[model samples]
Target: MALLDNGVWSKRFFSGGWTDSALDHPVVEPATGDLLGMVGLATAEDVNRAAARAAEAQRDWAAASPQRRAAVLRRAGELFTEHAAEIEDWLVREAGSVRAKAGFEVGLALGECFECAALPTHPQGEVLTSEDARWSLSRRRPAGVVSVIAPFNFPLILGLRSVAPALALGNAVLLKPDPRTAVSGGVVIARVFEEAGLPPGVLHLLPGDASVGQAVVEAPEVRVVSFTGSTPVGRAIGEQAGRLLKRAHLELGGNNALVVLPGADVHKAASAGAFGSYLHQGQICMTTGRHIVHESLLEEYTAALAAKAEALPVGDPAREDVALGPLIDRRQLERVHAIVTESVAAGATVAAGGEVSGSGYRATVLSGLSTDMPAWREEIFGPVAPVLGFSTVEEAARIVNDCEYGLSVGILGDVGTAMKLADRIDSGKVHINEQTVSDEPNAPFGGVKASGTGSRFGGAAANIDAFTETQWVTVRPDIADYPF
Candidate 1:
């Protein structure tokens, strides 16, 4: 409620404190198309300053005892839970998330904090057998400073997912949240850690647009860059990081597929598909963009799915009964509508809903899709599910792998058959009898091929290595034994 002071929000944090900029961008609520407030934009110079401070703080923070670091993170998790109500409200207003989605995002953020707090005590090194009479051990060392660039949708969780782990691993973090949800993503995150007694300059949140994000990525002080967003942006970041020889971790876009086998329960699969495709208005990277059903069950599954999609309540997020909220902004709304219209013209059938009402669009089901359609090949980050019929499991696998994105896939059928087919699917994750939109704090979450850059973000092992470098140490009992 007090996120904006006098209709303006600050962009600087931690080392820089609350600083203003020459230009400010308006923050708009998607549900009503109203301007909530304005957030100051950070310049490239500000990014350099934050990165420098983070590098400086990281040395002392890394040298501190693991218990000390864990204590701060645990306290931050507690603070996050204590302010859940305000954070939820901020998420609804900033990201256009419904109550359920907003609450889930906040809960996930807190869970990440707690989970990452335990990383310090976890196994971060190993003792290796050496040929010589010396002790050889490999340990993980912090990468000095880490830069995290989060997207607009689910900003709170995604931002914290990378930030928490990097900090827990002894690296100072510089978080640049999406301009759309700066309050929920950047401000709230910084406040939680600051209140938890985190040392000054250990964490910094810079709220701005693409320019600021690029600045962070190009900054020499930032040794590791973790980003979650569209694939085009991720690719650019990966290329830039490679050119600069900096470590990059990217969680990019996905065109996930949900396969309904012949023996699958049509009604159950339909419900799961509806939730997977429409949750958060289908803005998630793991949203089910394609629905491939066996030819024998295509009619039954399509009808059931259309009914479920048609029944979802779409309106302002503030309404308790509203099951779906608007897109992030007018541009997203227009782009979604255009995708549906173009697909329909290309011989795709709109099975359920296709019209855009208010700032929100209806949950739509499209059938009779061809591989040539844009919706079939591209990632449709909207509440639209395209159903395609496959003659066999082999055909289904082909259809699923035809696209460039292979983030995740859901299989609804016999466990044995699903597991067998999952091995052939070119995805990073496979869910049996479940939806594609699934994630856990302790599981390795990422994608392969074009969906991502093959860099994982979750799980203790993955997080620790993602933000750290390996160092090998050897000790000899006698100095004369060494070749001096």
Candidate 2:
């Protein structure tokens, strides 16, 4: 099952054809702890070279016709579609994703590519009113080079969400995926665009750690940065980007809530909450960390959710037919377990699976949650769900709004009442009759406050805003007399 053979990517380096670096980072399979292969480690100097090359190649790429740019993206989508099985294998072995999650991530990535392909044909500028007799226009221009720093969870979708759009809009990209998932997240991307006929240096996937990411952001040639990770890391990146006067689209951590309002079916609401909390082992940023249920339904909802969590099969996804897979690494496993233990210490009662199984955690549910509990306050990026009870609708809204992280929220109830309640919840996305773990390729996908830089990545409007810079131009047939 070793995949780094000569038939596939055999280079010491990941992409952009840099193979002379002697430094190497081992690509380990998370589930089985086997060495997949060795990828060349990138230095800050390599980042500088890559950025300079990207800047150099971006000029010609931006100058190409829109149809040509659109065609390249379309072809990339086709390549993703054709290589779905191979890519999913890499995801399973590299990122420890279950088959279904891996397949869904690839499908979403292809959808993102197709959606971005239309950016080239979309209107790039707008006519503006001019007080003077001259014509005024607002034109959209590429941001030169964009730096994309994606996390290990949902690597493919997160990486492609920003990469494809920036490339489609004529901006060069320097992607730095988490080293834990370098092959599936970064290497596969380079291969797709390379086969799609993207010019050399237009895209470079450099798999490295935090320092490499910092170098990518600090590169003089890079204009915009798109980051998806924790809030603490995001704050540092945002601070640095602010100092450099570069725009950073930061999608950070979340303690999103799944509120079961009155009149909703307790079983159905529990099903939604279970899916939100346990999907992909709850490693997603939008995972439902807190379940706020009506006091009358709290007991029933908690029991139903615990039953679902107890039934889910957890194992090495590459080897078994399972619902949940191993955590990405030891660090994540420790962090998740620590949060669960701390919450239990804080008087939370474990209702379901609480122990670790092999390299992964079992689906866990906790009741009697307090707002001050670690499981309730912190973003536990694991299959751990904490339940809280509220007496009234206002109380439910208060519980949902109490969290400082406002990424996404779910309210299970009538559409009319849910719409009214959604207005009260200060989140970037709200799901009615659905879970917080949801995404649409064409919808605006981002968060407010601690969640992210607020509705920055999604449909054409947001993508254009993130990857392009607006320039106001005025034209005069003749030169006017100067005041001087």
With candidate 2 superimposed using the best TM-score fit, by how many Å does residue 66's alpha carbon deviate from the native?
0.5
How do the predictions measure up, each by TM-score? Answer: 0.97, 0.97
| Candidate 2 lDDT score at position 445 | 90
Q: List the residue pairs that clash in candidate 2.
A: none
Give the local distance difference test score of model 2: 0.89
**What TM-score would you give candidate 1 relative to the actual structure?**
0.97
Q: Give the worst 10-residue stretch by lDDT in candidate 2.
A: 2-11
lDDT of 1 by residue, 73-123 (tens): 899899888888888988897799999998898788888999999987788
Each candidate's root-mean-square deviation in Å? 1.7, 1.7
lDDT of 2 by residue, 58-101 (tens): 99999999989999999989989999998999889888889999
Q: Count the backbone clashes (under 3 Å) in each candidate.
A: 0, 0
